[model samples]
Target chain A: MRQNRTAWFFLSPSLIILFIVGLVPFFYILYVGFFDWNAFSLQKGMHYAGLENYRRLVFDQPFINSLLLTFRFAVYAILVQLVIGYVLANLLATDFPGKWFFRVIHTIPLMVAPLAVGATWRLLTIPGFGPVPFYLDRWFDFEYSISANASQAFWTTVIMDVWHWTPFVTLTMLAGLTALPREPLEQALVDGANRLQVFWYVKVPLLRPIILSTVFIRLMDALRTVDEVWMLTGGGPAAATRYTGLYIWRIVFPKTDYGYGSAMSLLTLYFTILISWLLYTAIGQQRRGER
Target chain B: MKKLITLVVLLAVVSGFGLTANAQDDNWWATAAAPYAGVTLHGVSESTPPSNYAADVLAPQFEALTGIKVELEPTSWDQMYDKAIKDMEAGSGIYDFVYIEQDIVFSYLAQDYLVDLTQALVDHPELAAPDFNFDDFTTFIDDFKNAEGHVFGVPMEAFVKIYLYRTDLFGDPEIQAAFEAEYGYPLAPAATHQQHEDIAKFFTEYGEENDLDLWGTTVQAASGHSSSFYEFFESIAPTFGVYNWGINEENWKATVENGGQMNSDAAKEALAWWVSLLQYAPPESTASTWDEVAATFAAGRAAQGWVYGENTAWIASDPDRSQVVGQVGVAIPPLAEGVMEAAEAGTGYVGYYDGGAFGIPHSSKNIEATLLWLQFIGQPSVQPEWAAAGSRIVHDATFDDPLVVEMDAQTNGYYTLLQEQGYLFKGAPAHPFHAQVRSVVEPFIWQAIVGEITAAEALDQAAAAADEEMARLGYGQ
Candidate 1:
């Protein structure tokens, strides 16, 4: 009891800050979700909306569209990142000169701010004056603009997400690759397994745990992409890129309808929690199988 | 004898300090603000030229005179609204003064977030500055007032959106000959909507054939941004005779079923016309806001477009900022044959009267001090410099201010149009659910632009959504 009290006493400052910064606003949002409230209106005050907001959101087609878009974007972005990251990790796993320099270079995009990254991409993909389209036309003789078309806007954002975050996946996989036990691979080789077979059967299974954890982290981030899309297409080309996160932002700020926005956000939170639990269960099941 | 000499020296030093203090000509601000001296006032505004000038130039001058500090936070539009609204919503008084866009004042009033400046000025008449003539502010001030005619905010910047074209291109004899031959009319300032369309088509073809990196017009139709939606509803729609963007004033209805004209034939034609112009605009136009449009015109890419007058001084005359500085010309935006008459009858508007005001929030503890600051900024003496910096004039006297007169000449008489025809333009419709309505309509407009839906379909969906939103907000039940 004394140790528990001491532990809590030491944690009290962090607990207070965490409650203020993280938990309090979330709970406030949860509370606000239950009422019909406008963010800027105080005279009308909050009307006890009960489940109307939730019902409206659940039946909202645009809301459902945004959810599907976000899910697809996350899946696409994660898969692309994983493939690129795996290829780079494999290359780095082999002995090479100045390998650390290449690794540092790969990780540079991770250091810069996401907003800046988005801005850079916005400028680069500009149709007439920007270097990306300019070079594409001048060198490759291609006539295209990523922002002018809805599908291109969606795909361009996915590409941008892939570019900015693939480095993280690469580094995570690199760590896993370096920490892999060499005994299994050597034994497999002695057992007359080819490099491809050894990698597929031994290395991949050993790396599954790391791969799952890295993917889970990236899935969360990809599911909540707001800044890049805002700077790039602004959820544009006909609301084609209006992901769920951007939709929530539009509601909370532009619409200034806190009740509907909070309710929608609470649903998003539930989905996030659900995904986390599912991933954790999958990881637990894989671990048991490995054991 | 030594003690007596020291006393005499101390007396001389004290008197010298008093003389220096008297020489500081603060015009009584130092005296009035003496009590609040050292107290800091926080304000937030969007990062526009006028707001920046107020923050960088006027703020320091006021601070130096009054000994009170001003911390002005200039940020992006979305973040600025979020910060100001959140502060007012929480009643935390994070900002003593908030820059209120003309469109959002109704909602703010409905929320009771603003201090009643009429009462503040009356109660603290002694603190108001001499040159702060509330009456001299143009009709733009009406946008910042309540239905009871009580003023809530001090107008800072006000101007009409005007049609800007490339003067050099318009004057080129060879181009004129080609335009006449192609369109059977002499190339001149477009007076009708059809003429504007013809000019856009001519210049687009002209640029393509000549390969001069030019387009016909710059459209602020960035499908993803609120700016595009605003340009369509406020600047484009009314010009096509779709008044109030199809809101029924009598019952606040926005659906065709309720007698609203959002999906009317006229409005659908207007939307189709706007989307049709996209082919003539630069390819990036589908992803453009006012900022991009202005930049494109400044870079000599677009021949003509409806541009905000606040950009006139810099884009048309400031050589340091604009590449086609001397080539820019301004005229009243083209309207349908009857738009001007309808606008006069209070059924529509010819163009946008865009500006903003600074209002003290009710949550402010230093309302008195903030009022003094606002009045100081509102003084007629400060109008010219602010106008020169921002290309927007709120005071009547500013029309004749020497610097403004010079810019009026420099921009080929852009401000002349403002001084003469500013009355034709209108601000956003006064609605308490301004943000909510826009949120409903913007995406549909975007989809219309991108061909996912026809203009009629988009408006039909938008009208239904707006009606639902308004009803949900407890209005027009």
Candidate 2:
């Protein structure tokens, strides 16, 4: 009992902080989500809305569209990042001349602020003045205009996210690769297995947990991305890039519809939690089956 | 020696009058702002030319005259509205003054978000500057007034989105001859939609043949920005005889079947015409707001375009900012059939008369100080230089000021047009749900701009969405 009291005492501050910042807001949003409240409407204060916001959200085509778009964007971004990041990590694991320089250069994108990354890409892709279009037109006779083309705008945002975050994936994977036991890798080699076979059969199996963790983290982060995309295209070229986060932002900030935004936010949170559980459960089940 | 003596005496007499006027102005600030001397006023505004003048010039002048400090933050448009609205909603008393854009003032008043400037002055007459004459401001002030005539804001800047063309291109004998040969019309400022289209095509082809890095026109058609929505609904649709975003004020219906013209034949034609111009405009048009449109014109990449008047002064006279400084010309927008007649009869307007005003929020702790700062800026004595610097004329006296007259000449009669025909242009409607309705309606317009949908389909969807949204907001009901 004395030891339990001491542990409780030690955990009290962090618990309080979490309650204040996390639980309080979560509950507050949950409560507010039931009322139709517009922050800008002084005359029409909070009205008992019940599930009206959720009902409307079901038919909110823009929000639904944004969710689908966001899902596709996350799938593409995560898969690409994982593959490129894994390749780069393996390549960097070997010693080479100027390895430190290559590592630093590869990691620079992770250090850049998302806003700066968006802005730099904007300047780099702006037609007439931007060098991207100039070079593309000269080299391949291809016209590159993000503003004029929705497909181009959407892909550019994806490319921008990849550029900004692939380094993070690479670095994490590199750490995991460095920390590998090496016993299995050496054993496979001693058994006359080729390098590729050893890497695919032994090394990958050992690194699966780390890879799964990285994928889970990247998936969550990509789903909620807003700032960089906002800065780049503002979810435009016909909102082809209006992800779930930007859609919620439009509701909460510009429209000032607190109730609807809160409802949407809560729904998104539920979806995220559901998705994480499914992913975790599926991966865990796969590991268990293999065992 | 006799002539020099006479000139010196004349200079001294003029200097004395100025000194006496300065002394009187100083005395008013000293007396009116005495109580609020140590108080600092916090304000937030968009970083436009006029707002910059208020921050960089008038704030310091006010501080010098009255020991009160003014911390004015001029920032991006989105940030300005977001900051101001959030501060007002929270009632945190963080901002003493905020820029109430003409379009959003109705919403602010509906929310009771601002202090009634007229009533505030009436309640505390001591805060009103003696030189601040409300009557000196033009009728544009009517836009900021509630139904009870209680003024909520002091007008800072006012300008129309005028049609700008290249004088050098139009006057070029070779180009004019070539254009006439092709279009079979005397090349001048477009008086009709057909003429504008012809001019656009001619200039584009001409640029290509001559190997010049130029386009025919500039379009404010950013597929994602709100400026494109404003451009279509306010500037272009009005010229096509669709007014007030085609929503019937009485029933608040936006669909044509319900007596609104949002998706009417005229509005569809207008949208089609605007989208077609993209072929002749710079590729940047698809990503442009009013700011990029202005920059594109200033860079001389286009021969003609619709430009906001606030950018006219610098683009026409400041060589450092504009390559076509000496080549710019201003004209009224091309009108559709009966559009001019409708505008003249006060039933419609030609284009957007955009502006903003400084108002004290009800949540402000320093309303009295902020009021003095507003009155100080609203004084007619400061109107000419501010008007000259910002290309905005809010007061009648600014029209006749020598400095403004000189600027008018320099900008090819921009102020003259404003004085004579500003009534033809109108601000946004008194929609208390402006932002809400606009947010719902603009996406369809974006789809049209990006070729995701046709103009008719886009407007049809937009109109239906606007009607449903307004009803949901309890407006039409």
Q: Residue-wise lDDT of candidate 1 within A1-291, one digit each (tens)? A: 999999999999999999999999999999999998875443377888899999999799989999999999999999999889999998998979999899889899999898899899988997767898888787999876765677878888999999999999998998999999999999999999998999799998999989899988998888788988888777877767889999899888888888889999999889877897888888889999988
Mind listing the fnat for each candidate?
0.62, 0.62
- Candidate 2 docking band: medium
Label model 1 with its docking quality class: medium
Q: Which digits, one per residue and each the tens of the lDDT, describe model 2 over residues B307-411? A: 999999999999888999878899999999888888889988899999999999999999998999999999998999999999999999889999999999889
TM-scores of the candidates are 0.95, 0.96
lDDT of 2 at A102: 93
Off by over 4 Å in 2: A39-43, A282-291, B1-18
Candidate 1 clashing pairs?
Answer: none
Reference-based lDDT, residue A268, model 2: 88
Model 2 iRMS:
1.8
Best by TM-score: 2
User: What are the interface RMSDs of all the models?
Assistant: 2.2, 1.8
